[model samples]
Target: MGIELAWTHGVYVLFVLGIILMMVLRRDTSLISIIGIAFLGLTATGSVIASVGGIFGSFIYAITELLPTILVICIIVAMSHVLTDTGVNETMIRPMTHLIRNATLAYWVIGIVMMVISWFFWPSPAVALIGAVMLPVAIRAGLPAIGVAVSMNLFGHGIALSGDYVIQGAPSLTAKAAGIPVNDVIAASIPLVIVMGVVTTVVAFWYLRKDMKNGMIAPASHNPVTSSVFSSAKVPLAPGIKRTLAALVPILFVLDVVAMFVFDLRGGEATALVGGTALLILIAATMLAHKQKGLEQVTTHLIQGFQFGFKVFGPVIPIAAFFYMGDSGFNTVLGEVLPQGSHGIVNDLGVALAHTIPLSKEVAALTLTAVGVITGLDGSGFSGITLAGSLAQLFATALGSGVATLTALGQIAAIWVGGGTLVPWALIPAAAICGVDPFELARRNLYPVVIGLLVTTIFAMFLL
Candidate 1:
């Protein structure tokens, strides 16, 4: 194990610490992140002019990587606004009022429902759909707004996004990186995913329930309509249109999910199905409400949607840019020229750790988990999956451990953190929709997710 930490690797660690500090302090680190990028670029290139250019380039790179997520969110928010305008959002929630009769039931139902939807359509779009429909219902049913946020974050982002069972995108990334069949990683991931999901969500539910009993969590009169974009100009609709659109909207999304499976769609294809459906729904619903004036109002909704998207997109850009540096693929795009043998700071540190650490199955499991968590800091959970897979293979060769289980364990850790549960930037979609602070939401998720990861790592030992 020849572990030589480079100067760039040390700076990367410092920046990561800086990021965590900002999150802990509830401060925005966009400026600090940009500064970090500039400094990294300067150190790597030994050129002031190139380093300055790298700052803008890194930001652009980050935006390009996250464009799909931004677009999906913008389109969904627009669709939701149109639904609200037509009174369809309210009508949709009306039927669910009976099903979620109390706070306890509401919490579980909201989480479970988000998980199911996210499994099919991915959590980025599911956050909007679930938040629009179920959040208000859960609030009305006596769940605290923050508790509702926690439930959705843990289940949708933490569990479903981490596992990605239906889509299997996460597993495929890990599998491909590890040079193994996708099915092996997916099959290996089941127990670990289940253990992590069950443990984290259950712990969260118990904590929330206890908080409710202790009056720490508000049980009633929780404000659900907290986001500005969601509080739009709602027109009183005739019962017929409200009923018709409300019924059709969910069916359309569900059919879209079904079509994804039937046609073997995944990744961008699945995202397009969701986003395209939302856009079409936005058009039809807006036209239904405005009729002759539909042309004007539809423009209004799109403008509002883009505004909301950009608002969220701004803070996200710098954070993502800093993290994207952790992935080797972005080294050339985001920064100045690097020295020979130096690439991604995070991957380099990961390699150093793997080489330096003592060879033992137990130690390797925990080490890989830590590496996955570190790699996931960049906010795109799937980006670090390749590193996890590669490290798993590396450790297996050294320690004779099972590659599949180690890879699976690393995948869970990465996805659970980067996929959105613990990272504030990644938690934006769920946190923004639920009208909670993303950092606070990430803080809330910290304990449950960490505990779940530790337990799941231990469980993976037997399999190995």
Candidate 2:
């Protein structure tokens, strides 16, 4: 792995650290990220005009990449608004409310359900399926919106996605890259995944309980846009109608899950299916609740959803634009600026870090973890796993042992960070669905995830 660092790489690293520092300080990094893009453009192209254009180009690239996620969120939120307005949300969650009597039960039940569904259908669609029905119940049971978001995020995105046992997506990628059988990676990952999942979830719950006791966090509240939409006057559906719609919504989602299995749809396709169903639900609920004004009312709900979606995503876009440069976005936004044979800025950094480290079981395990975390900084968890897999192979070759363990370690770290519970943009689905700030969700996840990674890495060293 010979990577020639360019001036642009240094600039990118500087800005990445700056953004991270800002996040650590709880300050917004939008301006810093925008400026970083400008600097990168200027360094790569050496033209004021092109650099200015690159900033916009980067934004466009970020939006294009994020548009699918944004659209699904908007549609789901719109559907939720109509359900709330028509009183269907209450009826839908009434059954679950009996099961989850308090915050502790709410967190674990939501999390465990999220993990199971995500294992089958993948997290993106599972989030919509579970979050829509569960959030109200969790909140009603005294869990904060942030707590609900964190549970969905850590369980669905971090644990289920990292192992990806049922779908085999994550293990396939890592195993192929490591030149091992997929089963080897999966077998090796089972213990690590359990360790990470158990530790992280437990730590998070402990902190949550402590905070709730001290009154550090509030009970769930609606986001501004949703609050306004909920406040809007609409004709209430009859109790029977609400009960019928409530039953119908879950049946529709369950069918979507079944379709996923029959059709083998995953990721974007699964999300699209859920989003389309949400739109249909939105239209049906609007027509039933506001017969004469249904057309206008549905449009109004959509508008509010869009408003909420964009508001949540606005601060994230610039930061996302900056991180995108770590991968494919660099060349697309600013032309060929990286040195020849470079595997993008982030990948190159991971390779360089791996090369600099000495090879031993402990060093190998730790270095792979570091490489996984570094590569994950791109915020596309899967994007960097190939590099992690390759590095794992390299280290295992030198040590003559522990290839599977190292590969699994790297995969776990990468997904936990980027697939992800740490990255704000990557965790947006849970945050948006629960009506919480993505950054705060990321913050609440940081300590528990970090501690989990630390313990898991040590455990990996033992397995090695």
Clashes of each: 0, 0
Candidates in order, TM-scores: namely 0.89, 0.97
Put down candidate 2 lDDT per residue, 93-169, tens digits, no spaces: 88988999998999999999999989988888999888778877877787888888889999999999999999898
lDDT of 1: 0.78
Per residue, candidate 1 scores C-alpha lDDT tens digits across 1-464 of 44566566677788889988888788888988888887777777777887788788888887787787778777777877788667787777778889999988987888888899888777776776677667767776877778888988888888887778877888888888888898888888888888998999888888778877888754445443343323534676778988998899878877876797799776677777778988999999888888899999999999988887777678778877877876653565644344456546766676777777787888889988988898787777777788899989887877675888888888888888888888777887777666566677787788788889889888887787
Native-to-model Cα distance after best TM-score fit, residue 375 in candidate 1, in Å: 1.4
Q: What is the lDDT, from 0 to 100, of the residue 97 in candidate 1?
A: 87
Query: Candidate 1 at residue 166, lDDT?
Result: 79
Q: What ranges in model 1 sit over 4 Å off?
A: 1-3, 173-184, 210-234, 332-336, 462-464
RMSD of each: 3.0, 1.6
Query: Which candidate leads the pack in lDDT?
Result: 2
